[model samples]
Target: MTTNKLEQLKQMTVVVADTGDIDAIREFAPVDATTNPSLLFKAAQLPRYQSVVRGVVDWSKTQGGDINTQLINCSDRLAVDIGAEILKIIPGTISTEVDARASFDTQATLKKAYRLIELYEQSGISSDRILIKIASTWEGIRAAELLEREGIRCNLTLLFSLQQAMACADAGIYLISPFVGRILDWYKADTGRDHYPAAEDPGVVSVKEIFNYYKAHAYDTIVMGASFRNCEEIEQLAGCDRLTISPQLLEQLKQDNAPLIRKLDPARAEAATAKISLQENLFRWSLNENPMATEKLAEGIRNFAADQRKLETLLQQFWR
Candidate 1:
């Protein structure tokens, strides 16, 4: 019997399920799980999660707040409720995202993160078992830095450039999720090329660069390659510290019996000569210089924020 690719990849990287489907998480048994407002919102519409949504709605009514406040409260409650359920299935931590609208506000992000931690604590879950997900914006990084100091860990998401990764590292966050598929999508659209081999793939290149940079600097922040488009992309980054893959690709990997090659080596990272330290102005300008990163970063945030609003609207349907 040949070794399955999923099993092979597991030997080198920590597998994380990037979905809100409880059954999918159970089937894959990933080491960790991550969810965003969009995923939670999708799950809320399913018949199995109707009770989860209604439970939050009912609880929100008992608390004092306006309709908008009630909606926000219900959304947050539902996120943690879903997270709590996911935690029961996965032994590791869950990455519950803060509200995307608060992405640019450091203080708001901090307050919301604190609230999320409190909710988890109230439910008898330890703070160690949760990772607050935040955008990779400067403000978001600042908020994460503050939270990390107080013993709360965070996963910086929507990262598209080295500058973003470096900022997150400077903040000393627990993890950084550099999006791969999104970067590929941007390059494909811009260049009119639909096919890219793993070696030539812009997305794969971006992750490898970030991974090597992190290892070279000896930064403690874990590099998690996210938003994968295919199994080839996943296989190419076989030795990454972590890979949060969609269940679709995971299933694809399970079906393939092939030898997985470890493409990245920490030893090679020591040879990297490009090092950067950024001030506020330099960071902004550096990001601006990379048109792909700048556009994708903004687009990623806008899409997530839009999905968040959509999630809010879904909760409002049950308010009456």
Candidate 2:
């Protein structure tokens, strides 16, 4: 039997490819794949996807709308186009993110998510195979709640705190992607330390807490640890519902024949105490108090929004 870490991990949890590269998806063969504006922007630069990018730009030219509207529409189609390609490689689901600039606007986020689904459906992909990725802000959570009721699943991204995770579980979201690497990055920058064993890793600790909370409460919402910095972090959360790993780390896991163990277990979570309820005001305050979560959440949104702009610039060049 193959004993590579990636294969070993699949035994305990669903493995997700956190990228927009079709070649990488084909190579890793993850159960699912996730794409955000950043990944999409980087993928667009690849020569193989140039035609796909041009196709969206050409379609935008035929549409009746202002330049800005056309640009937004084209970018939306571009993201889904990339997702549709990725869906072909992965057997399970593809998480396409909504515009980060709309993170604070529930209605706009809902509409954008709906539009992405519509595009996927038009391509013959069922809504069941699509998970609309959104930021884990209060408004984003509310939008997810509405979308989930309408049969559209959601993957809440940019998650940083237990408050965000609990709120997502409360909303009955299909999945929540708690960023592991970013949390570690925050702590590393603040404390001026770099070395952290898996047990001592702040990122690993956050995901374990969220995973335990979800399993303890028996909430159906899946906890997928995202933005991992190393293989150790991935190995630490071996029994998580899912882990969205980058192509680089996926390759690392593919090569190493290290033994992987289940760090998180449902039975362990079953021993956890009662669940905690969070009101809107309390959720807001809790997030604000966690400086790391607050700063990282804002930074993440800004980075994604910037990537979206870069994508727009690339589209404008092709559109013109």
Candidate 3:
């Protein structure tokens, strides 16, 4: 409403907070918020959250609980505690992820998603107030489909390719978080190219193509670009459905040295004609055949899984 270049462009892109630092989230005022195991792990290790963890531990002692269960119970407690507070600042949803270790198991993923929703519900939040975050694997998509049918919205994370977006659309997910920085990382590593400008970076290219495809086909799945390296990259993606930017880049946008303009406009794509239908058989074949999607999906699941364990260990110590 300010008509400031950056603030005006924000009207087009659904800005999201890509961090666990609640103070940063408050300052930036991102519409929605997202957090994963890695971010949660980092947040827990910080001295500020020490009180929350200790409170959970004290509660566990009062209940005479199992150590492992109590520790994990503590993580669930913290995720909801922080998530609900963020929701107070922003009128949109919060993305609370399921354990990534269950990423490959459809049933386990569904079970974890249900548990996550129940945790939120217990915290006085409705299913509509939260999105169950899942990895964007075939298993994850299928699980998302099941959750969607049950009225649990999902935010598909670690998405890097068109194949993943197609599958997510097929699954009727609430949103898909395409990682811009990670995509940039892969392209830079594979192509051995440095010096990525805002408009031409491979990561920017990937999200742009996905955006054009989604708008062209009128796909209902909201594409939220994540993990950016610079404000230019974010500015270039102005027309995306949503973009989860870090506080560092958000702060950079507040300073005005150059003009900010919208790069993506839904009105411009009104003439597009392609549309898609969900086909599980086709989805499976596509995910199986795309080597990068296959490898990256597995690798992402593993990396998040590792972070989950590390956080669990830290929670164990907190319980002690």
Give the Cα error of residue 285 in candidate 1, in Å. 0.5
Angstrom error at residue 50, model 2: 0.7
lDDT tens readout by residue for model 2, 136-230: 99999999999999999999999999989989998889899999999999999999997788888998998898888888878999999999999
Model 2 vs truth, CA RMSD: 1.1
TM agreement with the true structure for every prediction: 0.98, 0.98, 0.91
lDDT of 3 at 211: 81
Residue runs of model 1 more than 4 Å from their true location after superposition: 270-273
Model 3, runs deviating above 4 Å: 1-5, 60-65, 270-285
| C-alpha lDDT of all candidate models, in order | 0.90, 0.92, 0.81
Regarding lDDT, does 1 or 2 come out ahead?
Answer: 2
lDDT of 3: 0.81
Candidate 1 achieves a global lDDT of 0.90
